[model samples]
Target chain A: MADWDWDFTWEILPRLLAATVNTLLAAGIGYIIAMFLGLAFALAQRTPSNTLTMAVREAVEFIRSTPLVLQIFFVFYVGPEFGVVLSPWVAGMIAIGLHYAAYLSEVYRGGLENVPQGQWEAATSLNLSTARTYFRIIIPQALPPSIAGMGNYLVGIFKDTPVLSVIGVAELMQTANSIGSENYRYLEPYTMVGIIFLLISLPSAALLRSFDAWVRRKLGMN
Target chain B: MSYFEFLVAHGDLLLSGTLVTAMLAAVSIALAIVLALTAGLMRLAPAGPVRWVATVYIEFFRGTSLLVQLYWIFFVLPLFGLSLDKFTAGFIGVGMNLGAYGAELVRGAILSVPKGQWEAALAINMSPLTRMRRIILPQALVIMLPPWGNLLIELLKGTALVSLISVADLTFQAKQINATTFMSAKAFGTALIIYYVMARFIITPLMRWLERSMARKLGRA
Candidate 1:
């Protein structure tokens, strides 16, 4: 154990910190894309047209069933083959966004299911339009329970940002791999990478838990 | 090469890779179930220290990324003069990581088994071990299988990471074939289809069947 080298750790600390920013950027962009795309997919599924809903559901399921790394590689490599060139960052965002959108769509579906049927009926009785009923009565109540699951996926997407490294996105894990390859000291780089993940994930998990609790209380489930 | 020609040439390699992936996922899930049960039960232990130890183990594993953990186990541990085979390292890493997630599901399922059942077992003058073995465990297993099935699918996806550590799984084979042939469309498209078939046709249906059987046994259906 004494073979562990502190000097190497110190040397790579700055590089890892810089790469940490890239990881955060990837997670933030992926989350924003997933958040909106998920809502879109959910709404698409709820659309009145049967053909559109089936197509959307099948697309979401296909994305959900496949591995994210494979999806990342597919988008990164295959897109260029089709004459649709994308930088690694853009490809990674699209893959992660599409992948998580499938999951978030399920969350939204559950949230929508939990919205009391009477609420829709009551809105209809008040002669509200379909759009007004959704915006005023349905979405407001349906969103909170889904927040916990959505937050979990946010942390999940954060953890999974390492896969972006495969496409040369220069994230924290990629930085660690590069540092380890350059210095031949795997301990510091990988351990530091793990620590960076723990530092970010643990706090975010706690915050999500509290937010979940607050949402529950607001819904009068407390 | 055209996609059709590429598929014909590399068909056997892709098949073997898919088999390797399925085998790895099966082995990892098996190991994960055992580890999850042990850790989950420990987490519910009456003794504070035992519970604390389990909690810390689960948290530490769950808090970090699986790739880092895999690299640490595969690359760093050997530096400490304890070398592991590539397959063992991959299996253990996947098992340990999924076990952390599975432990939570196991704990929740066990707790969901109903308080009165435990009291009823005690009232029958059964030994605590027998009570758990004969009554609690079987019911918990039924409840746990559905979530465990989902975790199993996650493990299947995770097996792809083993390729990074030189495990020669499906993703690795695709990458190799792609590098040689530059037929990314054929290689990855086939790989994606294979994954879809496994997850959709096999695993998802199996999980639904398990859930249905459990609900039937519990008379809840």
Candidate 2:
């Protein structure tokens, strides 16, 4: 059996912690992109134009059905051929951000659907512009219900950050792989990565669930 | 060379890759269902430690990254004198991960079976075990199906990660073909289409059919 070395784990701890910062940053930026892009996708699907609705629906289905890793590979490798050379960081952000956007769009759609039909009618009767109706009235109502799903994806995107390591983004998983190769001990680095992920994921998931409940209560949606 | 020419050369490689992906998905999903049922039952047990064990298993798997879990089994387990072949590792890793999520779905479905049904089962002098097997599970299976369809699709997408472990799955073949011909678009693009077709055309319809049949069994159709 391979022995676990305490000394080796301690030596690698600092580097792994540093790489954790990169992981958090990637998840943050990717979430921001997903939030906005997903909103745009959700709104696009609701437009009066049948063509726009159908196109957006098909696009969302395609993205949701495929794997994120393949999408990352496609953008990173295939982009150069079409005269678009991006750094691994930018490429990873775009690919992951877009992939999650498709999922978040569905969540947004569910939230949007939950808002009663009368709310829209009430907005129109009050002479509010369509934009105002959505932003000031309907979106606020939709958001409380959306928070739980949004939180799940937040954790999901963070967990998926390691996949970015495949394209060489120097995240936790890549760092662990390098450390293992250098020290000829896979046990320490890999185990360390799992514990770190568990530590971050479990607490964040709990926090998000509470936050979701809190948002619903504050909005009188409970 | 053009993308079409690249496809022409690598078509057989892509097809074989598709086959591996299908096989991997089939194996993992079957294993996940069994684990889900066992864990789901444990979660509802009256004993405290048994319930706690189920909770820990579900949360632990659900909380961590599947990639790390897969790598841990593939890399670390071997160091500990339990070296699994790639297929076995992939099966255990993905199956266990999906099992955690599926257990929750199973629990939810079981709980959704109305309370009066349990009372009625008790009145008929049925044992708790018989009530679950005969009365509760039949209804829960239909209720469990729609979400299970989504989980099954997620499982299919997850199988792509097995390629990272050198499983010669569809994603691996795409990479191999790309390496040989440097036709990144054709290689990855073909793989994408094949995946889309499988999810959209085959797996999805099959799940829907299963769901409908299960619903009919409960006389809900």
* Candidate 2 lDDT over residue span B55-136, tens digit each: 9999888988899999999999999899999999998899999999999999999999999999999999999999999999
In DockQ, how does model 1 score against the reference complex? 0.76
Error of 2 at A99 (Å): 0.9
lDDT of residue A178 for candidate 1: 89
lDDT of 2 at B129: 93
Model 1 off-target regions past 4 Å?
B216-221
Q: Tell me the docking grade of candidate 2.
A: high
Worst 10 residues of 2 chain B by lDDT: B1-10
**TM-score result, candidate 1:** 0.97
Local accuracy of candidate 2 as per-residue lDDT tens digits, A99-212: 999999999999999999999999999999999999999998898889899999999999999899889999999999999899788999999999999999999999999998
**Model 2: colliding residue pairs:** none
Error of 2 at B163 (Å): 1.1
Estimated TM-score per prediction?
A: 0.97, 0.98
**Model 2, residue A126: C-alpha shift (Å):** 1.5
